[model samples]
Target: MSHARRSVLVPSVMAFGFAFLYVPILAMIGYSFNNSRLVTVWDSANSPTLKWYSALWRNQQVLDAAWLSFRIALLNATGAAILGTLAGLVLARFGRFRGRTLFTALTTAPLVMPEVITGLSLLLLFVAMEQTIGWPAGRGVTTLTIAHITFSLSYVAVIVQSRLAGFDLSLEEAAMDLGARPVTVFLRITLPLIAPAIVSGWLLAFTLSWDDLVISQFVAGPGSSTLPMVIFSKVRLGVTPDINALATLMVLTVAVGVVIATVLLRRQERRRERDLRLAAGAD
Candidate 1:
């Protein structure tokens, strides 16, 4: 293709892609403010009202589900980050330990495994554990959190492993050479270098947990519904404006989080670069 034609084609395609992706989200946000009972039908005379937002606020069921999902997501993210970091550290740094291949495969099996299979297996395991040891009593928030953590940790491990693959080991070596213990070197030098990856992994795990439905459905018992579950049920009944408001609020929260994470990562990158320049100048 000619350069002029290619440029126009590229921009046109890009615009189309962006619109295709975001137009629905824009529509949802717009519909959240709609005054009509039917979400799609715009009531222009009484449009742009906060009625749905107010109704969503007063919805005890949604509030309970959101709180439950938030708590589970938070726990899942923290647990997944810690476990995944350890697993990644072992894979990246252990260097040909006994059963390394098996360990690595088992750790990453979830990435390729079907969610249905994973959920079913977890359900069976939980049932067996409960029957055998009389522990957990029954499925609830605890089971839901554990299930989320199990699947989410694999994602975090993959992210941490990828980050470590391109990382410099010289810093840790220098710390060790300076009489720092292995633990100290890891805590002081290795952790800081990998902090960005850990944060990214945590956020990804949180999102996964928050949005999970299939696994949560398998593991959750009575009165343990998550926000996704609630939304799914409500959508089956009909798409209401309250649901739209809820979704818009979720989108806003995610957007704000992404912005904050981007700013923090950029600042950290700048600080690291500045430090490197200063060290080079001193040397």
Candidate 2:
């Protein structure tokens, strides 16, 4: 093909692929405005209503479930971010001695393991622990958070490792050579440089924790139902209009956050490029 034709073909194909992928999401969003609770049917030819959105506010069960999900996600993501970043730093940078590979393997094993298996294993472990230690008392938010942390850590670790792999370490070396203490060098140079990766990892972990249903279902108990678990139950009863409204809201929030993040990242890249160009011109 001619170069012009190839360029057009590539962009056309990409546009088609993206539209195909997003059409369902767009349709779901549209359906959330349907006046009919039956869904899957047109609300009216002329209008869409925000009644479902208003109704969502009144849904105490959903509100509580969402609050619970948020709490768990924050706890799991924060804990996973710190713990996994430490592990990732060690494994990717300072790792030494035998069993290092084994530890690494175990850390990432959950990424490939079936969720059902992980859920079952964790449930069994929790049960065994309660029986043996009598400390946990019962499965609840704490147990669910623990389970989320276990699964989310792998994602956080891998993200941090990727960031560290390409990082320029001379900054830290220079800081240390300038008489700065080890902790000072780490705080000033290393942490700031890796902050983006850490934030990205935390967001990813939070997303995974929030989206999880199978694991949460196994570990969650009374008054500990997560948003996804509630969604799961609603889906089983057939997708209600209210559920569609909730899903639509979630989709919008996620889409907006992703778009904003992408824009910020691109803007940062452009700023860096401009700075480099200016520096080069000055030299």
Candidate 3:
């Protein structure tokens, strides 16, 4: 009887936990279809409608904010992936060198740093740079993208470094043995092997940048508001069905991206398995 009770208790607790986490999200999604303009209220008199989704397209401010956010995210992810890959390669492949400890510390610092502190520090740095060099002109998309890239590179670097930790160095050594230069070996062998990690890092960075509000709020100026900022401003006024619809659309987009990434990773795994089998047979 005690064993049965324990089992039931565990399942009951798990169900409760799941409901606690997902019930609000589910409710939010449901309310996106609500005919009521107010997000929180569901009226029995009115039927569910798709007007909010249509209104989303007509909302020029939201559209412009989303576009700017996408552009910044795209650029930030690309830049972070490149810089992080290089930093990861240095950490993973190069032996101890001058300032290695400092480099490692700086690369990983942002992972643990508070977002508010990072944002404030970056804002100060940008202000100082503008005063000194008279460049950047003012806070805007450029500064926002740079700030996102700065914080995001640490995450990408960690991912790439972990991917490289288990990587076989013998392949690179063999390429070099065959008279391939270091650059050639990296471009041909190392880069291809680590391509998946780079892609993953890029996606992670993009998501971080897209979802960032604190950092963007600090760095952004007039005419450079992001989707998160827009949503936040609307939320402050009072939640609207349009915002709910926007959030639901974002959730759908992220879900679809996850599904596609999963499929691609599975295909890559299958291809890798086939290649391993062919290599074994040849041996």
Number of the predicted model whose TM-score against the real structure is largest = 1
lDDT of 3 by residue, 1-283 (tens): 7688669889999999999998988898999999987666786578488889999999999999999999999999999999999998998999899999999999999999998999999999999999999878899988998999999999989989998997879889999999999999999999988888898899999999999999899989988999999999999988789998999999889888978997997799689879989998999
Report model 3's TM-score to 2 decimal places. 0.92
Name every residue pair that clashes in candidate 2: none
Task: Report the C-alpha lDDT of model 2 over 1-283, residue by residue, as the tens digit.
Answer: 4687669889999999999999988888898888887787785963499889999999999999999999999999999999889878877677496888888898899898999999999999999999999957898988999999999998888888888887767767788889999889878877766677788889889999989999999999887899999899989978788888899999889888878877886787578669879997999
Lowest summed lDDT across 10 adjacent residues in model 1 is found at 1-10
Clashes of each: 0, 0, 0
lDDT tens string, model 1, 103-133? 8998899888888999999999999999999
lDDT of 1 at 200: 92
Candidate 2's clash total is 0
**Candidate 3: worst-modelled 10 consecutive residues by lDDT:** 38-47
User: What are the clashing pairs of model 3?
Assistant: none
The best-first sequence of candidates by TM-score reads 1, 3, 2
lDDT of each: 0.91, 0.87, 0.92
